[model samples]
Target: MSIFPVYQDVVSIANLSKEQLPFFMRHVTVYKRKRLHHHDFAELALIVEGNGTELINGKPHELRPGTITFLLPHHIHELHTTESGPPLQVYNCLFDISLAVGPQSDPELSNLFMNSVEEFPAYTDLSGEAFEKMKRIYLELFHEYSGSSPGRNALIRAKLTEAIVLYIRSRPSFPVPGEKSLQPHPKDHFWEMIQYVHNHYMDDLDSTLLSEQFGVSASWIHRSFKKYLGQGFLQYIHTLRLRRASGLLIATDMGIHDVAVEVGFESYRTFSRIFKEMTGITPSEYRASYAKTMK
Candidate 1:
């Protein structure tokens, strides 16, 4: 199996509903430091204007016009912007597909989602006339969604998915160097460390260990993590462990203690405290809510 996840241009709210999905939309102008937060929803960020760095899973992806970021559930990430000329315009959508309701829930659809290659789930660049068309599609989808009408929600979902598909197909599959790839960024080394950390989050994690593993000094590891992922090593590791814990809480029949230990926590008490801090709910509560679905 590939390590990367695949993205199918979701084109209909019906498709999302058929797949047991939930969705939300918003716009934000971001500037400053934000702590890492975890969510069960799949997220999409559409860059309508401005530029910045999007730190995802411990790597930095350049964010600018036409940049679309699809973040999987429990993917720890943050955003930092230095551009002062224009406020970064973005449309953020969060979704869930656990109860998806349409053709998109097909086996083929499920298979395709596992094939995502680039850290940025998908990318496309639009300028001049093409940019206008892209803007129109987004505006129309938002308008239809917000307006009072029967099945407007369904209509919005369908149009939004279509807009995403068309946007993905109309642009290049690979990002240009220095724009959104690991190849040319000064923070590429940080990406390597992130991949390493992700592969080993279940093990004991610390800066000294990661530093030695990466053949760098502990300070370098700490700084790089903050610079690239916007969080310290310990914070990032906790995020990873908490995310895994959530999966277990929702997907397993194991007791809370077992789930805690399985995800590398030392004790159930510690696990409970951290889980509550990150998710605003106890492990038992989360489990109670999603356990039936797991069954």
Candidate 2:
């Protein structure tokens, strides 16, 4: 199923009730695609049919029927049809956290479903019978928001809260470490390798080099990295690069070209392409705007 009537840049403050939160529902019968540029909200997408790749931080993850992925604002991601057979159908919902609370709000709950940090996008999935329950609740909330029933707004808020809270409370495993390995084994060399990559990301990095350094096969590195981080190796490198780029843009007056090379990109063109693909903006534009905000 394709998510047609493509909704882009949908924004809402965090405190919105079911009635207040922006509601989007549609059917895409053809190959429909969208890139959410520099959004200030978190999003939840449910795929009802067909399949595609969810490109997050430069990695392509398979999106299948029954797949649900939540995107925090910091994540530079997009959805596209991988093939030309049929259009995929999807539902996208979004809301921003900044509007949810004042300075005195509970930091945890108030954060909504986004990660303030550039860590692997935080997410959870409901499987088996759990998805069915959430779907029913979502349908009910959607219907209410679509109707004019009395107290419908309150009812929608209650139900939406229930759906989100249930997922939050169930505590799906963090993507970076996978759901397993809550406790670190002394010999868990994978964590050591991950830490190594995190530390040296800005330096010349590659799968072959990582394999040689870590004494593992390159393919093993690829599999383990994705299993834990929800992305492939090169994608993770680009994520680190884009994250550092954001910091430089926000914190320094360096030229965009210099910043690109400093972050390990080879050329301005490649840098701009990657930056736009990841954050939905060119490096110079991001730096200029961020500079304005800082002043």
Candidate 3:
């Protein structure tokens, strides 16, 4: 267990619907700051007023009206308000990656999440017409998120996608020092590979198989998995499988071995061992525990 706080969507965001939309939006006023923390979901904050400094991944960036900060999963960050100024006000938005980008998303837009953190700055300062455009988008997002209008989900997703695309467009095209340029980059196909794994995690997938399918080397696959996802190839696959298995255990009447095989585990024994190792419970125990809760 890590000492620092790691917020998850299901727990941190209120009224987050797993079956509906994995999105949350709110107007936040920060009178004081909290301890440094990271989250499992993606976040975008548009500073509407006040003065502060945002510390992202140990780097400080000035915060004021028209400043936009986008944080990916596991990017440690903290916000601090200047004593002389009023509380920092911002439209804070939290969402899952699936809400903004998907398998069919434009590669350039998908790169916003897939590209390495070192390749681009997390915060961007906006001014003039560009800032106003983004401000309107965030305001519209807040309205749609809070309203009972029909087609609300679709509109919210569209606005969120627009905000992300605009943010990406606002970034400089040139690469940072010692980093490869954005165009003609090596990680262009990385997002595609990630989507492929999501769509086929239940199959026999590995770095070698993905490498062949994506025309990238096995070493590159391993490195990208570590760099972008913060986990190794097999660990990532097991994570997906275990997540699906956990859901099935609670949501269905499938047998333990059947659930394991359904999630791509070839051996029941291996699935049980890994499930216990990762979740600290056997498959049968997990399902029974859920049943007990229901009762």
Compare the candidates by TM-score and give the number of the best one. 3
Candidate 1 structure quality by residue, lDDT tens digits, 133-251: 76777777667655777777677667666654555456455545643433233633655566567657778778888877767888878776676566777777887787767655554
Candidate 2's residue-wise lDDT over 59-114, tens digit each?
45667665666655445456677667456777555544333333543466456433
Q: Candidates' lDDT values, in order? A: 0.62, 0.60, 0.74
Residue range 54-168, candidate 3, lDDT tens digits: 8765456788998998886545567889887799998988876555567755676676655623467777888999999999999899999999899998899889989988887
Q: Give the per-residue Cα lDDT of candidate 2 at 267.
A: 87
Task: In candidate 2, list every pair of residues with a backbone clash.
Answer: 1-49, 1-50, 1-88, 1-89, 2-88, 2-89, 15-100
* Deviation from native of the Cα of residue 153 in model 2, angstroms: 2.2
In terms of lDDT, model 2 sits at: 0.60
lDDT for 9 (candidate 2): 37
* Best-fitting candidate, scored by lDDT: 3
The number of residue pairs in model 1 that clash at the backbone is 23
TM-scores for every predicted model: 0.54, 0.47, 0.63
